[model samples]
Target: MAKREVRETSELRAIVDSCQTVRVGAVDEEGMFIVPMSFGYDWELDESGTPRLTLWLHSAGAGRKAAAFGANGNAGVDVAIEMDCEDGVITGPYACSYSFAYRSIMGTGRIYPIASGEDKVYGLTRIMEHMAPGAPQALGPGVLDRTAVWRIDVARFTGKQRQPKA
Candidate 1:
């Protein structure tokens, strides 16, 4: 498979940027890869290093995701966020498809379950922020207790982008 070039610093960060929600792919012991769900980028970068993606994952309390993770601790993940370009365009009819179609993102990271209480709380907060951009959302009481947070330390991330001429 060919790799895409990484440009525009913001593109690199934009993948996990203000945009929330990402699909996580995990492999099962049966050698089957299953997409757990659509998680969002909870936290960005901190004093530690590269932005570690924060996710609010939910299992049936137990299911494919849980089993897959158990089989292989080191999981493979892929995320793609697509924006609507020219919806519909035609010539004679009256419309012509024309819009910008660009995507900047990369996949490949190590999954490390949040351990520290503070970090977990921080990550959870970030998740909420991503979900509700500028909305005011306060934790009810102990919302953290029921939720599980996973942090993906971006090992290798690269993306490519192209826009319509001005």
Candidate 2:
């Protein structure tokens, strides 16, 4: 419901920035699959300073994810940051109260494999920075050759939070 929705752009960005991993959803010949993956992202700005979010991910050159991309480039992604939880509190005599507090962002986007060496390196660098800040920025050509980098240009997204009812 709207009461649970997070409408501020800054808040949504915070949720994304706080999370280290994203759940990527895609469909294949067999069926659908949702997998957790490490990711890096960039928030690009337009002339008016509006922000555009794009996610970067990496994987082996060949595999189920690669195959799924080949079949369908469309995908959905979710990033969640759990803030806290409450448990074992008896709200009623008959049952214990349980609730989780978390902030999350989810959206649909088109995934594409980055083919240009320079672009791939840039994306990979962002990924490394997010996963391991202060780590090496340089990625060897051999390593790049063995890795497949992908980008998701998010078209639409929404943020939501569930908190303990006051």
Candidate 3:
């Protein structure tokens, strides 16, 4: 076993692209809250070569998620997200040696609502493109109004992998 510190931005992007779902975590009056749901993401390196990642998520306009993230409010709430692409099980002769192979990305950021109709459409389009490319991305009238679109501009992220032995 080796240390899990993935510093390469390309590798981190790959890990994110390989998965369709992300687990988002936040805290509210009740305590810690988390949910696993499908998502869409974008990643790029800025002019200074700093990595930038953005995630798009959608849910009902009102719920626990919205409450935890202050979706209906002006203030942004801190959140953590995680996604993983599982490879397979790594079998071993002994129990201690057994492990699963996977690549994962974990990040922290603030989540805010996409207030404008144009921005909501954009976020929904990205999600559709990532979840099912070539599918019709056009939104019907008032669809954006009924759905809650959220954006997460990942401040920092890291990737890790445990590859199976050859």
Clashes of each: 6, 0, 0
Whole-model lDDT, model 3? 0.86
Off by over 4 Å in 1: 1-4, 34-61, 70-100
Judged by TM-score relative to the true structure, which candidate is superior, 2 or 3? 3
Model 3 vs. true fold: TM: 0.93
Alpha-carbon local distance difference test for all models:
0.51, 0.74, 0.86
- Please name the candidate that would achieve the greatest TM-score relative to the true structure: 3
Better of 2 and 3 by lDDT: 3
lDDT of 3 at 60: 86
Please give the distance, in angstroms, between residue 69's alpha carbon in candidate 2 and its true position after superposition.
1.5
Total residue pair clashes for candidate 2: 0
**Best-performing candidate as measured by lDDT:** 3
TM-score order, best first, reads 3, 2, 1
Candidate 3 per-residue lDDT over residues 108-159, each given as its tens digit: 9989988898888888988998999999988888888789989998998888
